[model samples]
Target: MSVPTVDLLALCTTIKAWGRELGFAELRITDVDLQHAESGLQAWLDAGHHGQMDYMAAHGLKRARPNELVPGTLRVISARMDYLPRDTATDWRARETARLADPAAAVISVYARGRDYHKVLRARLQQLADRIAAEIGEFGYRVFTDSAPVMEVELGNRAGLGWRGKHTLLLSREAGSMFFLGELFIDLPLPVDAPVSTHCGACTACIDICPTQAILGPYRLDARRCISYLTIELKGSIPLELRALIGNRIYGCDDCQTVCPWNKFAQRAVLPDFDARHGLGSADLVTLFGWTEAQFDQIMAGSPIRRIGHERWLRNVAVGLGNALRAAPSEALVAALQTRIDHPSALVREHVLWALAEATERS
Candidate 1:
């Protein structure tokens, strides 16, 4: 059976409209010519900046060649979905900064406080692709939302969703960096949107404010030292040197995004999926540390944090408890550490023992 021909330009216009109807804040199309990003990606990989994320190096340069990854791909549609919760307060930034100051608070990154973005964006991207197929019969396309080897930021930058900020995240003057990105690689010869000029200017707030100095310079990030990577990506014991620097950020860190001046323009999620769950926005370290494996599993269901599993979840909360102990000794905090000190997993026990030691050293 042959696919019917359609007006590509008009179809592009209709696709964008459909995307808006489906909750995507903006959608733009760009040809799959990521040749410009290959070298920088190679340099980042060569420097071992990706840490234990071996998957980043697994695909080699296929990551920069979308057509190679998805053969016959002619155009890529990049979509952005703002994730700041719909009811986010105007003083949300100030509140986040204060939470970091309260040593007993468990600071999960804002994004992970809600449902997993991977599930949300992948489903929506597929819906958009289905809508396109309905308009022009069948089309060759694949939907991706951080699950593949594709260079999402590069594709998004080229698609004019936003320019890459100094922190190396795609930033928009209109919507800032508080959003998720997804790509629809399709065979359609849709007109491509022009790349937008970067607006970072002389601002270095994101780099200067990093707790672990992960942002080495303007755009360089050393993930091994990053609090987010240390708390979430690393499987073994958190490094002794970087453990204290991890502070109370148990799951992920949002310091770079929180301080980025562009985030003031960050829009709220039009969809409810991104809203905080289980009071995670204001959870206490001691309370979170007390959750049994079953409780953690039950509470964190449908959350991005669940991917880390109960053991790593215990590992992270122990680190936060350790940092909290160092800040101010609490019998409750020390007691929580004691309960986990005999945990079956050596990984959890090691972090728990270290946390208990924090209280002793503080005294």
Candidate 2:
């Protein structure tokens, strides 16, 4: 179907205005070409950096060629939402570092502290699309948020959202790396924005602070060793070598971001949706580990953490508990882990046994 005729420049202006109204912190349009990122992606996959995310390799070059992946994808309307929770303290980075030192604290990635962003982004993007449709009648477009094979970060960079930081995350000088990215592939030929110059000169703070050395080099991340991928993506035994380095981060790791100089400028969410929920921002390992399977489901029903399921939940908390034992051994910590000693999933049981042993060794 032919795309409805619209004044392209005026439309771009309206789209950006609509995006801000929809709570997106920033939005820009880019053509559907991602040839620049294709080779780097292929090399990362070849090096097995994607770990068990076979889908990264399975998609082939189709991922870079959005025009082919989704026919009639003339322009990608990229959007970034600042995800630092609304109530985040001004000294949030130092506060997070303090959490890491508190052995009993349960550190979830800031992004997952609230409602699942996949749902939030898709709904908001669809609203933007609907508003556009209202302005120009029927149109061809599909909204995506961390969905499928979309090269979201590349599109965001090309659209002038921000440069991909050395840690491989999109970083804005104004907003830092505390944000989520989404895309709208549309048939409209929107005027594209100019790409921004990278400002990560001679700064390896992100790489230097990585607990697992996941950042093999500037702009190259080995997901296999990344704590986030280990705790959330890998659905098997937590690799013993990296378990202790995982620290008390049970869901995702923000060490790289917290340490980045640019993140000092990270912006807070305009919408309250990204605010920390259920006191997850302040939860402790023993307290989190003590939740029963039913309690886990009930509390985590609308959370991104729920996607990891009860078994993985126990597994991650167990790793945290074990690390906590070495940091601050207590009868309370050991007893909390003991309650899950006979968990039905061997994954959970083994981690619990390991946690118990960690406490015993400390004693």
Candidate 3:
């Protein structure tokens, strides 16, 4: 079961080359030792910073112990894929900021605007695995994007893909934080890469710009207060205290990344799969809230936003529409909220009522 030293080195080199051909921006290998991250993870969990993501606590230390998760795993191949749409304008940051200021805009995070990264990265990673099998004989391996108990950022950090930024995202000097990470947990003992030095310096831009101040400090995030978690992860009531801070963001929040200076170098996707679909990049809250449940399912068929299901989608849009009504008293926004005020899902009904009240209070 042992590979020759020279052959292992050659295989590692070839694997990286194949990864590039498959659209990964960069690929590096790392050993399965995440012992250094275990304490921080435990402390975060103990503080309940993971919010309602019970799955984060479900796997316990197996998240850091890759070998335990997949027995016989020796090395993990961490791959990065930049997700900025290929047609991204040079002033995309300024444009995003403007969208946030426009109360009527529905600011879906840049990442979720296209096809689901889980599907895109998982398929590409599996294809890379298949290629590895074709190169070597049958190899034991499992591929993962964000769908498992794996600590992807830590793995990517250890693999020399990037250092962990203050926002807790893996950041590269070349590609920044606007990228998706996937991994290949394989039995191959490929030569491990060196970890990169941290480059965040004294920058606190990400923390300062968070709408919900979810970041407690550098590298410490309270997911319970995070706008992304509130909209995408939290399943119950949107915390009343934080709803106003949610602004018009209907999906994941990107304030942290948008403000990071490193993202000035964020790369664009080589694959068309990451391109914006259905005018999501420029959509208004009123327009998005007007979509029928059937229309939402059909339009969001291949997108990651669909996973939230139509109920939560409506709930998020209701919050956005409410925020818009408070900011500008838009009749269109109020009318949209009324259409769903009687929706069957109580979650949708509650949010719609709150949205209507937001406008009424302004009167």
Compare the candidates by lDDT and give the number of the best one. 3
TM-score of each: 0.98, 0.98, 0.98
After superposing all C-alphas onto the true structure, candidate 2 shows an RMSD in angstroms of 0.9
Clashes of 3: 0
Candidate 2: deviation at residue 245, Å?
A: 0.5
Candidate 3 weakest ten by summed lDDT? 1-10
Give me the overall lDDT of model 1: 0.91
Per-residue alpha-carbon lDDT of candidate 2 for residues 1-363, written as tens digits (9 for 90 to 100)? 786777989999999999999999889999988898889988988899998988887879888999988898899999999999988999999999999999989999999999999999999999999999999999899988987888888898999999999999999989999999999999888889999999999999999999999999999999999999998899999888899899999999999999999999999999888899999999998888888889999999789999989899999999999999988888888889888888889999998998888878868
lDDT of 1 by residue, 167-281 (tens): 8899999988999999999988888999999999999999999988889998898999988888888999899988898889999888999998888999999999999999999
Number of the candidate with higher lDDT, 2 or 3: 3
Model 3, residue pairs in steric clash: none
Candidate 1 Cα errors over 4 Å, as ranges = 1-4
Could you give me the TM-score of model 3 versus the true structure?
A: 0.98
lDDT of 2: 0.91
Q: 1-363 in candidate 3: lDDT tens per residue?
A: 555334888888898899999999999999999999999999999999998999999999999999999999999999999999999999999999999999989999999999999999999999999988877778889999999999999999999999999999999999989999999999988889999999999999999999898999999999999988998899999999999999999999999999999999999999999999999999988888888889999999999999898899999999999989999997788888889988999999999999999999989
The stretch of ten residues in a row with the least summed lDDT in candidate 2 is 354-363
